[model samples]
Target chain A: MASPIIITPAQVATSRDGEVVMLCLSGNWQITASPPRWEQPALDRPLRRIVLQAAAIGDWDSSLALYLSAARTWSGQQGVELVEQGVPAEVGRLAALLAPKPTPPAPQPQLADLVASVGQATHQLWQETKDLAQLLGECAYSLGRFIRGQAQFRWRDCFTEMQQCGALALPIVGLISFLVGVIMAYQAAVQLRQFGADIYVADLVGLSVVREMGPMMAAIVLAGRTGAAFAATLGNMQANEEIDALETLGVSPIDFLVMPRIMALFLMMPLLALYADFLGIMGGLVVTASILDIPSSLYWIETKSIIDLSDLSTGLIKAATFGLIIGLCACLRGLQAERSAVGAGRAATAAVVTSTLLIIVSDAVFAVIFNILGW
Target chain B: MNTASGKSKFAIEVEGVECRYGERVVLTNVSFAVKPSEIFFIIGGNGCGKSTLLRHLIGLKQPVQGQVKYFGRDFTHADRAGRQELLRTFGVLYQNGALWSSMTLAENVALPLELYTQLDRRERARIVSLKLAQVGLAGLEDYYPVELSGGMKRRAGLARALALDPAIVFFDEPSAGLDPITSLKLDELIRQIRDTLGTTIVIVSHELPSIFDIADRVVMIDSGARGVIAEGEPNQLREASPDQRVREFLNRRVAAVQQQQGILHP
Candidate 1:
């Protein structure tokens, strides 16, 4: 029997006691003769005792399976005695394959190896890949469930979500867009004055603010404000098992929990973006009127002419799209959040990342479609 | 028990239910019935089909092979409205207590009412405060779940369970991680609810003390191949002769190590 390629941490907890037991490769545990080359020595040094653990691994996928297979085989030949009772799951699964015990002892059970089983190291790899695929599928399925529940949603909950998206977020949206407008107008003044095309600054400000800047700024602000807020709120709920609780309670989580949030963003975002557009243009109007000595009436006339219904509609459409993506991503990340305190931070970060990425991608798609259609 | 309402007369019948996840078979050919108004306890080690069995009772999981009937209704396959109708008559307390952390105590307690009922906000507030008070969290209604201790959160969760005045309440594990004192208090609360409302209760627990304290009859599941090995009043089973599995379970020992006396007395 050749020694299987097993590289485990030199030590592992093999008993139910709080004590950590030692594993001697040659004496206590040994390689066995098997076609698949399990670590068990089937004929002579029948693997008398072993302990398996899930997190205690020192090898990649294949090696981990072989090590587990070896432990399982060795245990099988000897009726599966254990030094690691209440064994961790990874080890528990491995031991289970051999012993076939209906009620397998837990990885940390007192009789160290008393019917213990553990998973192979490959299980972690399997879980990570599986979880990602599962999350994506869950997202799509959740949306399907979402669409069905929309009609049945309680209007009051929608009001509460809209209230938060509008009332609570207004201050931040107003403050930031106001600041951005101030900066844009200041930047436009410096650049336009240099070209002696100072009067044409109206064209530049009106077109940019109405068609692009207004909606873009609004979406970005929301991504930071409401987007982050949605993710954090939902993430905390996920960590606390509130989502699962809702399901157990016979509440349609989508109608009761999500519809209001989506509705809130849908209503507030475009409205806020429209407000930002007006404020942003006024900023440019003020700067031009004061510094360049252009009359306020002239600035207003030029803005009205350059910023038509099409320009305003384009920006509003972009704001609406961005709103959906930002809110969806935030809530998705939140609902999919992890269980730890750090998971909250991670969900917030993921919400920001996913929202920003969606924003840019969506903007690009919108631009192309508009250009093709000559909007 | 008051016995004022016959709601406690509804029984939970889990018949020949089978379920599997992909290739892994989690439950196979399992069956049991929970009597009305009596605390029925499901006791098993982890992964021994304990939670899966509970899901069936609550219509969370539909059996592929058989069905679960709640008071003679075809519950396992019921639609949302049907399930919702059935749910209105009962309460469920999950294994983790599943409180929404974002909402305050009062808000969380009021959620179910807010969902299915048309009570005004003030009315909701009044009922929420009353429920919280029942759980000894009266003034703490504004506290978030994170702000409260584990025991407090569980109590708040209990208040939410009792929010709608259901005819029965189901608990996943009423004393999982709390200290013994808190666990005992929760048990006493369970007893009090039963005494007061005479509500039919189904509890899933492995804690021996809790089982002996609140459960009227304990159903013990041993292995996958072995269905239910024992089902009787906890005190009766504790005193009566039992199979080796039942005896080991009652004594909280490793069943495999002990041999059956096999005199056909059990």
Candidate 2:
């Protein structure tokens, strides 16, 4: 059906007349088998040129070209010239098409490079901070305008975002908070049991759940969930030029895109935090009745005595702060994302990381402020 | 306008095809056939279903009312593996290049090669370099798609599309985002690919310069009619198209060039 190809190893024979090395190739060099190893031969005399003799070669493709290129590279390294006069014209053209270009040398660094890089990073940070502050100021202004019935954002969009951030987050927040409560009660019970002070476990779990773990856990979950969603949605819109289109049509991106999401997270955070606190305290009650053999009424009385209106208010305050952090971080990262498809994924990851960091840092600050005020 | 006579010599045949996107009908009663190794162009204004037709032809979408035969084989109903075998015989370059954002240019080119061919890594890399160099993008193997310019990105996309050396290559607006000089260079590169490799080319473009320069035969789609209104060589259509709209679309470029020269000299 097809022409059969003859085979042999490549043999380089040297002639004394012109000091040329002729490589005689005979085979089916059609990329089916391994190529012949043409080792660089040691020459006593000055090598003038290396030429390929392919008169006995059969059908071929890139295999012959790769072999020729390797031979050329070897000859060039040995300071000998490779002449393509005897090879087929098609193989020559294929070899020439794939001839590798020499790469440019890398630039040398100087002392000014370090100074310029630091200066550039500092300027970028300052510019970004300024832009973020401007966005926040505009959002606040829009909020004020809305209070006076002048803002252009839709109330329906705000309600929709609120619904997503609030209702959708309940199950996850409930699961994680209940687990955290169980862990705290279990750990505290082992130590408190040695002192015959099992009732104090109720105080520990209830006070911490209401004051710290409730708000922090809810904030972190929302940071990973709603905040990331916000970044990806807005980043995709930016990449598709929809944000630009909105601006072209006399709609402010801040008013149309950012405000609704920010309002939703900001207003929904306290409610979600309160619900987490209830689930966490219930988890403590479950562990108390099952593990510590404490009466349910006694545990409830101890929890009620330990938690006051100030403790509840402190957790809500942290929840509200964490919500602002998540909302702002998501919006900032998304709006500043590169206008590309890949940038949307990066924006979502950055939003989650930054929101978690800001939430924790601000929660610590709230703890210190509330401690100093003795709340 | 159906120009093909029979299916024996045609590499691709589309007959009585109708395509819709949801409730809106985009194209209807479209029939054409491309001879083997010819550079064919599909040209139209925006929203004229040039891309929709391409999707149907490439087996990505099924037409509502007709059949697409590839080499006399029914393509509209080919199963998964059958369609994959069919796809191995052709390549497509989408709008925005659509090179994977994660991989480097070399890896992107090597993707289809790795999937379809039995070439080893060393040979695959060599072929990658050759294809990139073919598109005038030598020594840019390690660069990511995001780092490249629009023209370089398009060239990288072309390199990836040509990785498998398919019999036919489809390009969706290859010169859409390029400058005039870069667009001309792209037109020349497309011609070189067709002539050098003898690969059949089907291009969809709205740009007049590219349509006239590289197209051996052109099909004009109009959204108002929801079908192909004219088919011929671009120059033939410019001179002898019976439809006024076809003449206007082709003649507008001549008018723009003449007006530019007038503004420069007078």
Candidate 2 residue lDDT tens string, B1-266: 11222356787888999999778899999999888789999999888999888878876567999998776767788785566566666777776666666469998798777656789999999999999999999999999888999888888888887888877888889888789999999889989988888888899998988887888999999999999999999999999999988998888744455554322241
For candidate 1, give the lDDT. 0.72
lDDT by residue (B1-266, candidate 1, tens digit) is 21223343347777787766556666777777777777889887766777777776776666677887677676778787777777777778876678876678888899888877899999999999888888788899888888878888888888998998776688888799989999999888888888877777888888999998888988887555535667888877766735765666677775543443222222
What's chain A's TM-score in each predicted model? 0.61, 0.86
Which candidate number would show the highest lDDT if scored against the true structure?
2
DockQ for each numbered candidate: 0.31, 0.02
Clashing pairs in 2: none
For each candidate, give its TM-score against the true structure: 0.68, 0.57
TM-score of chain B of 2: 0.91
Interface RMSD of each: 8.3, 18.8
Off by over 4 Å in 2: A1-20, A28-38, A44-49, A73-86, A97-103, A109-127, B1-206, B209-266
**lDDT tens readout by residue for model 1, A1-375:** 998965433333333322222332221222332212333333343334454444433333333345565665566666755454333345445444444447866687465443342354467547744654555464456557667763436677678778877777677766666666667777888888898877777788778877777778878877887788888888777766677678766776655666567767877888988888878777777788888988989988887887778778888899888887787778777877887788878888888887888799888999998899888
Model 2 lDDT vs. the true structure?
Answer: 0.83
